[model samples]
Target: MSATTATARPTRNIESLTERAAALLGGTPDDETLRRYLNGLSGVDAVGLEARAADLGTRSIKTTSKVWALDKIVELIDLTTLEGADTPGKVRSLVAKALNPDASDQSCPRVAAVCVYGDMVPIAIEALGSAHGDPDDGGVSVAAVATAFPSGRASLAVKLADTADAVSNGADEIDMVIDRGAFLSGRYGVVFEQITQVKAACVRADGTSASLKVILETGELNTYDNIKRASWLAILAGGDFIKTSTGKVQPAATLPVTLLMLEVVRDWYRATGEKIGVKPAGGIRTSKDAIKHVVTVAETAGEEWLQPHLFRFGASSLLNDVLRQRQKISTGHYTGADYVTID
Candidate 1:
């Protein structure tokens, strides 16, 4: 726990403390009540509580980052449908689908990320470009799903090994699914630990660190407020990026989920001066939808967020439309969606 939190752990009960805080900040506050209120804010995992509280005091919010590569986005859309279940030919076919570099100039992605499951990291890392003489054109560096993906229910040792195995196979980033059962059960420490431990296991061959994006599967969280809280919790607990879903859940990513996360990113950065990333995976399948996300960041979070670091679409289906729109805008001719491929 952060010293701030350790010092602020409530010494008294809520009613008395909140009342006291009101009196101290005075609009007619009470005794120990004030202590409780301050304790509440200070008691959140020290990193999250006090730091976030400090951030809430800022004057204005900065926007998302602006500099990012579209090609990178096109490169990393994890086609999880083919993972583990596919043979080498099927995987190669999917890889072919992934590395296709047709989207160029105005018709390209905003830089795709490499999406492979634990078993496919080596293939994706080794075969992501045309430079290898593969028909595939470009893609982001590899990102492998870890932490017993699709569900974070597992022994910590197993989860850690999964993360290490992916990076050892060449994944540049680790996408870890958080333990929702723990989070929902109010076992915050376990949830925090699962992520931190997974992140710790994501080291490069040279001993550097791979970035971590924690998946909350927002649909199951059930409320914007809880989603926002979870975003804060993940970052405070050591997430490099806060993601919406695992795509395995129904009612996955949504505008509201993205909006709340953006707000938290805005808040977290302001508080800690650390820029956290955001990814909205699952069910976001249209270019217009992708652009709407862009619009939200451009407007709510600021244009600075246009880059791949601060923003990404965890999609297998959206790129086709983005390419179609880019093609339509660049060449002045609208094309059929199939020209780009859907899955």
Candidate 2:
């Protein structure tokens, strides 16, 4: 797609974000404007934030509710395989697993999407076949990690090319990593411009835009305050979803971090009447942990955020554990590992 067309796309306009920022900042979204708005954010009470997250984790649900949570977890998972060794065959297998998480039970819900490297988008789409469609419509979507994923160290041209290629190859969603260096150094405008450009690159041939999930790499940001700032910056840049990490960091998705990100989304929705999705990727490995996140989402962002379009779990192993838990719920006993397909 031409740059003119990409920039002209109303859905990915940078002004949409700047206008919102302007309303909040009382001026255009320049470096000073961003700094003022971001720095003006309320300080996060680390102890209180951690305590609340822990308290939310301790909340429990009934058996019937557990069953529902398990299914919802399965449905919200972005079955991911972002490895150097990933091949077309591996992507196809992942797509198959996403289409049918449980082979024995036809009633088992399919995952929300299959996330792979940008180059593997076609492989996933081909494998998904008829089941490849919008995630909101119960069809599995293909999500590709773009913008030099895991480490946003590339030039702007390369990043935009990476994103454009993925969208042209039929990726329904693009997960992009922000330039943490710029963000950390207080060059918020650079990060904001990059996110807007990447969102523009997500425009497909049909005039529709692929959803953009901006990865904050919260682990690298170092403090709760910075994480909150990055979350707000990402939302202000028109990211459809604000993601926690790339699953390659030391401390991927923590409860406090995810909760903080959800709070950002919650506040943004309340102020603008627009809903933004949140995906807490990495390190979330079990049904129990996923349920805690579910509870956190409900309590922070409300029940409306539980759907695939509104929330997602960027996980691979987490799905297997959820499948086991789901089987136990249906059979009154836990099934062995061999029951679910290994990714």
lDDT of prediction 1 = 0.60
Which ranges in model 2 have alpha carbons more than 4 Å from their true place? 1-14, 334-343
**Each candidate's clash count:** 38, 0
- The ten-residue window of minimal lDDT in model 2 covers 1-10
Give the runs in model 1 whose Cα sits over 4 Å from its true position: 1-84, 103-110, 129-139, 331-343
lDDT of 1 by residue, 1-343 (tens): 1111111111112244234324434433222332233234422243443344343322231111111222334543444442456555565555565556352553343234546786776665555543221112232445678889888878999899999887776666678998888777666657765665676676554545666889999999875556765786677556778999988898898766676688778876686566787888999887545545665666557767655556777877666655654454456352332223211
Worst 10 residues of 1 by lDDT: 2-11
lDDT of 2 at 261: 92
Best by TM-score: 2
